[model samples]
Target chain A: MNSPLFFLSYFVLSALVLVTAMAAVSFRNLVHCGLSLAFAFLALGAFYILLGAEFLGFVQILVYVGAVAVLIMFVILLAKPGVEERRWGWRDLVGRFAGVGVSLAVFLALLISVFRSPSLAVKAPEAPVFSIAVLGEKLVTEYVLPLQATGLLLTVAVLAAVIFASQEVTKK
Target chain B: MLEDKSIYPDLREGRRVVRPGGKREAKPLNFPARRPWLTLGLAGAAGVFGALVGVAVLLFLMEWLKPGFLGEGCFLYAALADLDRAPAILLNGFLAYIASFVPVPPILLGILSALIVIGVLIGVFLSLFALTSVVERKVLARIQNRYGPNRVGPCGLLQPVADGVKMLVKEDIVPAGADRVVHFFAPVVMLVPALLVLAILPYGPGLVPMELSVGILFFFAMGATTEVAVFMAGWGSTNKYSLLGAMRAIAQMISYELPLIVSAVAVVMLAGSLSPEKIVETQAGYWAGIVPAWFVFTPWGFAGFLLFFIAAQAESNRSPFDLPEGESELVAGHLTEYSGFKYATFFIAEYVGLFAISGLAVTLFLGGWYAPSPLLAFIPGYIWFFVKLYSLVLLAIWIRGTVPRVRIDQLMEFAWKFLIPMSFVVVVAAAVWHYSGGGFLGWVVCTPLLLVPYLLFGSAFAKKFAPSGRVYRYSQG
Candidate 1:
């Protein structure tokens, strides 16, 4: 059984996640949206710690809140000022409605799947050590192919970034 | 004096005004003879007295009043491990007394203990951070053949206190157009990462605040938030200068942090652990019972240390790489809009960051808390750690004094075109050395592997940046 402190922290972090997520979507300023999104990510990271994934939690904070969010803010700051709000047309209104409809449908589907899962009734087993050493060993041995695939993906992403940055579009 | 417009009225207008004023007055003809030595002596005596009182309290608690309140063998066990258990033990005893009257959950006790430990650490290190600023200023002033802050209590020993008071009492300004919430949060965000990184540093044996299995990764992970904080400050300020400064500062930090992390990878690879204490422990033995097995001595490690040091300078925004706050150029960068205690908070963050990174360097490349030689083992490891750490800090100050700030373009070039490539070579060299067991043949193979690239890159860099000899024309000597 978990301690009440654990539940209290979980509730606090979940509250942070919900609030920041809402703020991220609803904030008017693009920079504020990005920052709120970063806060959401940070809260999620804290949630990971509550789930007994300390490394994953810190990595989330390091990568998403630190790098990705900073990069988003960089682009936001670099974009031309006074590009805030735009007038909405009929197409835009329709698009907004469609987006909301799609998201609601997806949420309902996810809810059904979670409730329907047989595994949901089972209690969690005691967590493994899951230390960095164990993680590294597993990655190299059992999950080596996935690790290589991730590396490949990262390389391809870097190549794409280089191509986009250089901007020498071949007129083929 | 508090007129905001008067301070920088023309800055926004892109104009400079020269006020005609009387020439500097000669030294006062009727100046009284001042006895600075008396004040200095008194300050020294007071410091010694304070230290003695602290020691006496520690002794009284540990020996004379070994509180029966403390569990049996608690003191001996904590002392044997060399952990800083004073705060925790004291808190436990206090809490136990409370728990005798009222029930306390184990979780609550644990949480309260952690809180007390963190509180004590923050109090102690914040004082150290303040002292570092005063130390840096004094050292820089001495290097420039000037007395610094002598008016503030005996050789400026009390200067940080005065500075803190000034920062607190000064007006806190916010530009009308600034994002008030984000601006308020920026300094707080900035301070958090600096403090967080301090948690991972192993001050001495068993003295780590939090010994995460991935301590070094934790340090860098916390470090990543600094750029985001910088960006927030810049964007929130609504000033072009602040935005530009923030961008430059963030870019510099991102750039330099690459080599900094990569260089430490060599140490991590060799130590086979990410924990700072483990890394230090691996470097404990002696080569010939004289030379301590510090990573700095290995060829690859030597290169990595140099790379880490240089990149750290940029990351910390110390001079030569201090283009972010280039006073003559960017008007204090992201800090342009900050004033008073807000600015002082940023100042504290920078110094704290400097100390943290340098302390990391010590843990990685230097012998950490280990004495340099076995013969000098009488001095404690924590003392040795601080000695090496402050020496690096002084070296940073010296470099700041000696070198001119590099241009932004040059700074970027140095990180990407030079340091990053060199770091890769150093990593390769470490691998080679490791595989070869770092014997004589390994040196033969790895030295050129490391140096050839260095020579080529150094020549290319020198050719581009080094000034050609100047010839004077129309000189009538």
Candidate 2:
């Protein structure tokens, strides 16, 4: 695993992910778009694997592919078989312009920062055995307070969902 | 019609046989009758055959083309102390896994050895599908109670197999207006992740075929894959019922998953590792009655177990949270358009997911691979693991039969209001309790501490947020 080869794989996979993401936003058929999204998610996972982040890769696939994409498709299917848009409308054209402009601007900013500083892109250390043990141990022991905070956040989310759901019901 | 019970012998497509007086007649079996031994034998055989052929193919390729490629895939062998670079072991394992699909007899002894320890997993999977059908039938029958599939096998044990065959033989219909590619791929996409998840699972001690360190995360990821696949199935079918079912499923699974992960975090906290094998090992050892030797015995242990169990059930799309396939309102939910083997895939995937969840529970909370009592850790891990795993499997069947599916909103509220927050509180309390230790009672006392908050302020919460049942009725009218 030369860093050069690693960087090459990363570039290829990242491009694949981008291509898939583009298909997701650009596809005419909603189902096709959902699939494209899943593919992008999966490609991102492959990128994670190449980066030696197997768990992260698994998470990307599991979360985006397993749950989110299916959900979006599911929600879309609830409506009748809507006709596909044949051409870009006024809003579609304006939206794409805004999106691309914003994206390019952000990319240029990042590029400028990288070029000017030339310090952020540090070579990573080769640390082996970043197994579940290391992650779990770090999460519980070193990051205990934050872990506890995550619990609180989850609990608050639950309570909020309950309260909001209840409010919605009572108003009805 | 009354007398001629003699049935078809080929039995591929729902045929029957008749006994004329004294002679023994092979009865008119249902399409998917309880042929447990047969199904197990065949599937197990198939797995072995597939593995052998797969090995031969790889080695053949290596000899023919690339000599070094075979050595690259052997992560385990590479880790071993004195193993040479001969590609046999790696190729053998691959072949055995692939050999699972072939039909061969001479390899039975070797197959048995290969299936060893992990057999309980395959067994648990097959049984989950079998028993869930039985339980669902029994429950539906009890609700209506004329006794459900009892006529088929023992308490209608053979019913799932019958159902499976029947589903397989039935007309394979793809809805005309559906997304052709997604529709075709949905069931497979859903099922492959479900089945693959089993590969990384450590059913008991020495039972895991592949012991990846990121086991829990991998398990969660697999669950997510199934979720996406189900979403695809529902949408691809192009049916209103399925689409609605998929939405409910998505919402419900997403909401419950938060709590589920929180509960799992509790285990990662306690067991101190994410590997399923490590979790089980952490739980081994004793107190007074063999120390109960499971994470379920800690201060928040019982509460965590309950939360994890309920969430796991919900995650797997079982009762009383089977909103994904609200059969009454949504036909077969995500599976409405599926027929034959495609439908069967969904059915078995559900069962496999159920088994996987239970196996994880046993691993995380219930001292997996360790005996019912911690003292029996000496008795080999897979046995204890399967013993408890099977018990949970049975319990799942029992619950399926005994309960009815709830409304979508109610399901979400129950998770949000009752299970999720409670699990979160319990997780923190458990961590604190683990730090400040006494006995099981110290851990158990956290129960009253948590309940007191809800018990006291619950009225205010109740008043502001109307329960789902009332809301459902109000909306319907």
Candidate 3:
């Protein structure tokens, strides 16, 4: 698992993720940005697969790359026909600096939590042979409440979206 | 002028058409008359002979190689286990033989085997794509009472070849306003996912290309990329029709994908695994040592199969569900701006996508490679797999021929109002069937559970949406 090929692929995938994520944010064309975001999501899924969470990787791709990215593209296409170009003003520069500072702060907080975690202090254990069935069992048995909550939240969101869309249609 | 007119039938009829000179007409320099059947027969015979010879050579090579030299994964030994495993074994044996002498690393050997599997899958499915393209036209032609592409070699069997040649030679046109990179990559993106999905399907007992724990999820994940690719094609083309077509396709796909995945979830629940191989294994054996215990044999399974089939049809953008590429409105949809081999690639991707979906249906409901009866178990599993697959493809073609393209709104309504609810019913029915000990009691309970909703939905939809009567406005009734 820790073979040179593994390291090579990991590095390559990470590079792809970073490149695509950067492109997603920087691209002027909204569609291009959406596509880049999809690629980023896909690369992230690949990272999940690399970490041996095959089910999670697939779900990540299916939900994010497949559904979320597509929804983003749909919204972009439906909203406007032209590229979204914003002038770089003093306010924009200040906002960028503020955004950088916030992101850096968040990153540092995450880094500190990771370094301080008790699990990380211990020697790494043997990689467990994880199966989807076990994960599903845990979801239903131990994490059933969370699962139900998520489902309920999603259902409500869907209903709200339907209502909103239907109202607009009626208005039109 | 009169003498020339007498030599030509049209001229003699006073049409005054110019005729080629007798010297030019008399020149029969080369080529025999088109003997399509004879050519086809010869090709078939040659192919069989070549395959036999190739098998014989492989057998001879296996015989000559030392048995233990290639180690445990050697095909020479595996081939002896079951004759059905012979093809895969022989191929692996050949690879193993190379590895034995070459001192290849284990990872490289694994990669090599994976590559071979990928290659074989691509080759087989691409050929299937070609065959389906011609067969689809022929089936549609039969439905329409028209001869389809009979002028091509051997009753249009070689039409795909001609089409390929034509596509290859044709100009690769790109719209001046199109985004060059995105436009160029769209077909490739479309093709990659179509091919990738094929990897997870269990073609036979030990014949899956890439067996992952989450095979079904992987398949759906790969399939999701098609939407992105379609969007790329539409957006990159900078054509409104293309964009609209892409949007329609994406919407239709997303709507139908819910039912598709949910219906499959029923099977996964019953089978107790996301892996297609596991699902197929759970579906093995006969009910009374006669009927194959395919999922479609059960009531919920049957309903799930239907829902999956319909959703699969919509997913592949086939006729009836093909509102995105509705010819009356959108000129080729997202494909309008594509030309030549790029267009050909898109066409191949569509058929391959169809094959993948059909293949998945076979895996889930029809029993992946299991024979219909124990009596038919003599046939190889992959053969049975392909048989089921091609049958589903034929059914798809039949439906495409019979049904008209559905309206986009109607398509959405069907997916959302009917298919989704029915699929949920199927999942519940599947759970009931499982919990109730899965036999006569299961059937009695599940059938009505599925049927009642279906009937209610059908009636409600029909009452609300079905046109009452067509009144003649300007024409006499």
Candidate 4:
């Protein structure tokens, strides 16, 4: 698991994720940005697969790359593609600085938590034999409340979306 | 006729006999026509002889290169000995044997074996694509009362090969204003997911290429990527027709994907595993040693299978749901700007996508590779899988010939108002069936649950969209 090849692949995937993420943010074309975001999502899924969470990895791809990225692309395409590009102004500069500061703060907090965690000091546990059945069981049994809550929230969101869409049609 | 050909009567007669104007008959090759059975026998004999000789030569070369390569206790020998897994075993064993001589790393060997599997899958499916292309045309021709392509080869069997050559030799024209990079990569992007989806399907016992834990999820994820590819193709083409087609495709795919995945969820729930191999295994065996215990035989399974099939049809953009590529309106839709090999690639991708989805339908509902009865169990599983697959493909072709292309609004309404709700019902009924122990009580509970919604949806849709008498506003009765 700790083979040099594994580390090499890990670093490569991380680099891919970072590069794609940067491209996603910086691409001039909205569609290109969406595609780069999808690539980033795909790279993240690969990272999860490397960590042996195959279910999570696949789900990540299914949801993010498949659904979310597609939805983003649809929005970009359907929107006014002829809109003139706006020149960077003082507001944009301030927004960029604020975004960087927030991201740095979040990253530092995560880094601190990881470095100070007792689990990091202890011997790493053996990787569990991963199975979809176990994940399903855990979701239903131990994490039932959280699962139900998430389901309820998603259902509500879907209902709200339907209602909103229907209202638009009715208004038309 | 004599008056018309006053100077060249003999030449005219020869022309009339040789080149008849209408409905020219396909001439059978002379060798086969002379001795049909003998020719067939010889062909079969030659094929077997060639295969055997090829294997013998390969083995001899291997042994000559390294003495005791096929000796007792060798892993290669052990693998090759398994006749049931002959194709896979031979390829893997040969690669492993070569690796053994080369001192390659274990990881490289693993990667090589994986590549071999992928290569084999691609080879098999690409040929299947070729065969399917011709088969589809022939089947469509039959449906439409036409001769189809009888000029290329015997019964136009080699039409795909000829088409491949034509596409290869033809000029690839890209629109001047098109995004060259995206335009170029779109077909490639479209093809990659179609092939990737093929990896997770359990074609037979131990025949899956990848066998990921979340195989079905992986399939859907790969499927989702195609939407982006379609969009790329449309946007990159810089053609209104292409953009419109791509948009329609994405919308249709997104709409149908819900029902498709939802219906599959029923099978996954009932099978109790996301892994296709496990799902197939769970569906093994027959009830009372007679009827195969395929999920499609059950009430929820039947409904789910119907929903899944319909959604899959839409997903693959077959007729009744092929609004994206509606020839009358879109002029090949997203494919308008593509030409030559690029167009051929898109065509291949479409068929391959159809095959993948149909293969999934087989895996989920038709019990993967299981035979219909214990009596038929002697046949290889992959044969059964392909038999079921080809039947579904034929069914698609039949529907394409029979059904008119659906309107965009009707397509959306069907997916959203009918298929999606019906699929949810399937999921619920599946749960009910499972909790009720999947026996007589389960059937009793699930049948009415499925039937009522199906009837309601069908009748309501018919009532809403029923053709009414036209009102003549200008005419005075």
**Worst 10-residue lDDT window, candidate 4 chain A:** A77-86
TM-score of 1: 0.87
Q: Please give the C-alpha DockQ score of model 4.
A: 0.67
Docking class of 3: high
Please provide, for model 2 over B24-138, each residue's C-alpha lDDT reduced to its tens digit, 9 standing for 90 to 100: 7676554334564676677679989999999688667755564454465543344243232222244355555445456555456455655653564577677766765666555
Off by over 4 Å in 1: A81-83, A168-172, B1-42, B50-105, B469-477
Per-residue lDDT of B1-477 in model 4, one digit per residue for the tens? 000101122122112233466677545445533454676577679999999999799778878999977688655566556544656776767777778778988888888888888888899899998898877776876787765555454455677788789888989999999989889999999999999999999988888888787889999988988998999999899999999999999999999999999999999988888899999998898988888899999989988999999999999988888889887888888999998899888888998999999999999999998999888887778899999999999899899889987788889899989999999999999999989999899988898998998899989997888879999988957
Model 2 residue runs over 4 Å out of place are A1-19, A62-84, A88-127, A131-172, B1-124, B127-161, B374-379, B444-447, B451-477
Q: Backbone collision count in every prediction?
A: 0, 38, 0, 0
The model with the greatest lDDT is: 3
Show the lowest summed lDDT stretch of 10 residues, model 1 chain A: A76-85
lDDT score, residue B222, model 1?
82
Local accuracy of candidate 3 as per-residue lDDT tens digits, B197-316: 998899888887787888999999999989999999999999999999999899989999999999999999999998999999999999999878999999999999999999999999
Candidate 4 ranges with C-alpha deviation above 4 Å: A81-86, A90-124, A163-169, B1-46, B59-82, B99-102, B470-477
Scored on chain A only, each candidate's TM-score is: 0.87, 0.74, 0.86, 0.83
Model 2 Cα displacement at B75 (Å)?
Answer: 22
In model 2, how large is the Cα lDDT of residue B391? 85
Worst 10 residues of 1 chain B by lDDT: B1-10
lDDT of 2: 0.72
* Top TM-score hit: 3
lDDT-sorted candidate list, best first: 3, 4, 1, 2
